[model samples]
Target: MTAGETLRGLLELTRPVNVIAASVLTGIGAFVAGGVTSHPVEVVAAVVATGLAVGAGNAINDYFDREIDRINQPQRAIPRGAVSPRGALLFSAALFAGAIGFALVLPRLALAIAGINLLALVAYTELFKGLPGLGNALVAYLVGSTFLFGAAAVGEIGPAAVLFLLAGVATLTREIIKDVEDLEGDREEGLRTLPIAIGERPALWVATALLVAAVLASPLPYVLEEFGAIYLAAVLPANAIMLYAAYESFSDPTAGQSRLKYGMFLAAVAFVLGRAVEVVGAA
Candidate 1:
C-alpha cells in the first residue's frame, strides 16, 4: 500500500470521530464541574487522556476483530490490508501509553478512573464483547466514565454525576439498537449480544424503555438548579429526538441508531449550553 493509504488506515483504526467525541465529553464534564477556567491544566490532561484512551480502545478492538471484519466489514483497515494487525496492535499500545502518561498527572480519583478504563478497554473485545448485555454495559460505563474522570480531575464530581447517568443510559440504549442492527453478523460469529439473547424486537423494547426513562429524567438538572432554563429548552428537543429514534428503531434499527446518535450529540450540546447559560447568569 502507498504511504497515504497506510496513514489513512492508521487513522481509521483510531476511529477519529469517536476519539474526538469522547474528548469532548470529558471537557463537558470538566466544564460542568465549573473548573474549566480554574483548573485549565487538569482539564487539558483529562481531555487528552480520554481521547488517547478512546483511540487506543478502538485500534485494539479493530486488531482483535480483524478476522470478524473480514466477514462483516471487509473494508475495514486490517481486513482490507490497509493496515496490518501487528501495526494496529503496536499503535494501540503507544496510544495507551500516552493516555496513562497524561492520566498519571491527575488527582487520585481521576487516575483511578483512568486505570480502570484502560484495563476495561484492553479487555473489552477479548473478554466481554461476546457476552449478552454485559458487553453493552461495559461499553456504556466506559463512555459515561469520561465525565466522571474529567470532574474528578478537578476534585469535584458532583455536577458530572447526573451527566454520567444520562449519557450511560442513552449509550446503553444505542448499544442494544446497534446489536439488533448487527444481529445477522453477530449470529454468524456466534456472539450472544442482548438482541441475540432476547429477540430483536424485545431488545429494542428494552432499549426504548431505557431511553424513555432517560428522557423523563433529562430535566432533573434544570429542576435541581444545576442548570438554567436554557438547558431545559435545549434538552427538550434532544429528548424528543431520542424518543422518536427509540420508536423508530422497531422498524429500522440502522436508521434509528444513527438518529439516536444525533440525538445524543444534541443532548451533549445541551449540557454545554446549559452550563454556559448558568455561568453567564451568575456573571
Candidate 2:
C-alpha cells in the first residue's frame, strides 16, 4: 500500500475518537478517585498503552469479523481493501506486545489489570464475540478498564470504580441495543448477536431496562454523601438525558440513526457526569 493508504488504514484501526473518549474517562476516574498523583509520566504511559490496546482490539475485531463487516459495515478498512486481514492481524500483535511492555513499567496491580484487560479483548474477538450475552458483558468489562487503569495509575481504587461499574452497565445496554439495530446485517452474515438469537422486542426491553437501572443508579455516590451536591446536580440531569435517549431509542427499533444517536448521547452522559464528579470532588 502507498504511505497515505497505510496511514489511513492505521488511523481507522486506531479509531481515534474512541481512544480519546477512553482517555477522558481515565482522567475523570483519576480525578474522582482522589488519586491524582504527580505521576504524569506514568499517566502518559498508561494512556499510550491503553490507546494501543484499543486500536489493536479494533484491528483484531475487524480481522475476525470481516464477513460480518462486509454486510454490516462495508466501508470498514478491511472490507474496503485499505488493510488486509493478515496485515491487521500483524498490527494487532505488535500493538499488543507494546502494551504489555508499557504495562510492566507501572505498579504490579496496574500491570495485572492491564494484562487482564488485554486478555479480555483477545477473548472477546476470539471466542466471546460468538457467544450470546457474554459478548456484551465482555465489551462492558473492556470499557470499564479505563477506570481501573486510572485508579491503578495512582496505585489506588475508590469511588471511580463505582463510576466505572455504572458506565460499564450503561454501555452494555448500548451494545445490546446496537445488536438489535444490526440484526438484519448480522443475520445476513450468519452472526449470532443477541437480537438475532433472542427476539427483537425482548432484546430491546432488556436494553431499556438496563439503561433505566444504570441512569437511576448513577446518583448513588452523591446520595451516599461521597460526592458533593454539585455532582448530584450536574450528573442527574445528564443521566436523565441518557435515559431519555434510550427511551426514544426503544420506540424506533429499526432506525440505525436512533441507535447511533443513543450511543453518542450515552457517551456524552459519561463525559458530563465524570467531569462533574471530578470537579465536585476536587473542590
Top candidate, metric TM-score: 1
- The residue pairs that clash in candidate 1, if any, are none
After superposing all C-alphas onto the true structure, candidate 1 shows an RMSD in angstroms of: 2.0
**Native-structure RMSD, model 2:** 3.3
lDDT tens readout by residue for model 2, 1-112: 6879977987898788987878776765566555555677667777778888888887788888899788768988888888888998999999899888777778787788
Worst 10 residues of 1 by lDDT: 158-167
Q: TM-score, each model?
A: 0.91, 0.83
Q: What is the C-alpha RMSD of each candidate to the true structure, in Å?
A: 2.0, 3.3
Candidate 1's residue-wise lDDT over 29-113, tens digit each?
A: 9998888998999999999999999999999999998987898799999999999999999999999999999998899999999
Counting only residues 3 or more apart in sequence or on different chains, how many pairs clash (N, Cα, C under 3 Å) in candidate 2? 0
Runs off by more than 4 Å, candidate 2: 67-75, 79-81, 254-283
